[model samples]
Target: MAHAGTVSKHPEGFEDYVKRAKLSMPPEELQGELDYWRSRKVLQRMLDGGLITPDEFHKIDELNRKTFSPKLARLMA
Candidate 1:
């Protein structure tokens, strides 16, 4: 269960939050943001094209979180 996907637009200001959070971060943290977004872009493209199943996308999303969290933690520190 690992397919690519995009984050649908959220009306709860998540996009703004992500932007602001990235700007407020230190250099290392900003790099983490870059990495996260780059990976996300790949997923987004697949999703936008109606390419992945929900279960597969969910699994990939979970993997993304797991893969990036520790890296972000190190950057934040």
Candidate 2:
């Protein structure tokens, strides 16, 4: 079930989270937000062009949210 770009099967522990947090500073978080918004634009285009269903778009959006972990994204979107 693992794909090339997929997350690892092993669960991340607290230390992992802390290390990741340290690495992903505010700048990285901002970049993640920017990336999320850019993706939303593409996703919107796909939906508008009838390339993807609304349900499918939403599913991708949810995945993007999890992938980016953008703050305030849930509130805004």
Candidate 3:
């Protein structure tokens, strides 16, 4: 028999690490980080499933960097 929804392996203290990190972030920043991670996962799945070529992935990533760089620099300043 196999267990369902079981995580067999993770780094030690991973949950605690994530909890502390999340607690340290402002709500808006946390939400933005979460959204970014979710989007990356979806993009990876699309790449893996042959839905998008590696060249296309790189192009999209480059476009994202170009699009966001100004906003990110403004936020950093």
Candidate 4:
């Protein structure tokens, strides 16, 4: 049954929510999310300023796919 303010047919109970939050990212992983956005901004600026060609930017994107750990990628996704 749904809890107050929750629409899920089988709303996760409070304990489940607490456990899921506890299993979520550690401080380091949070920091990595910040770093990813920062680096993405830099890449975007480079593209905007014409400092890097589209092809070059794409190459860097490809590199990022390889560089960011799969776990980080999944978290970001």
| Better by lDDT, candidate 4 or 1 | 1
Which lDDT value does model 4 have at 22?
55
Candidate 4, residue 66: how far the Cα is off, in Å:
3.2
- lDDT (10s digit) by residue, model 4, range 1-77: 32333323222242343254455665454444444444555787999999999899878866765664323444323
* Candidate number with greatest TM-score: 2
TM-scores of all candidate predictions against the true structure: 0.51, 0.64, 0.50, 0.52
**Candidate 2's residue-wise lDDT over 1-77, tens digit each?**
33434433333232343354444445556556556666787898999999999999999999999998876465444
Give a tens-digit lDDT track for model 3, residues 1-77. 11333333333443453465445644444434343343455666899999999898777755644543322222211
For model 3 the local lDDT of residue 28 reads: 48
Clashes of each: 0, 0, 0, 0
lDDT of 2: 0.65
Q: For residues 1-77, what per-residue lDDT tens digits would candidate 1 score against the true structure?
A: 22233333333433454654454544444444445555566776787888987676667866866776524333322
- Candidate 4, poorest ten consecutive residues by summed lDDT: 6-15
Better of 2 and 4 by lDDT: 2
Candidates' lDDT values, in order? 0.53, 0.65, 0.48, 0.52
- Measured by lDDT, the strongest candidate is 2
Model 4 clash count equals 0
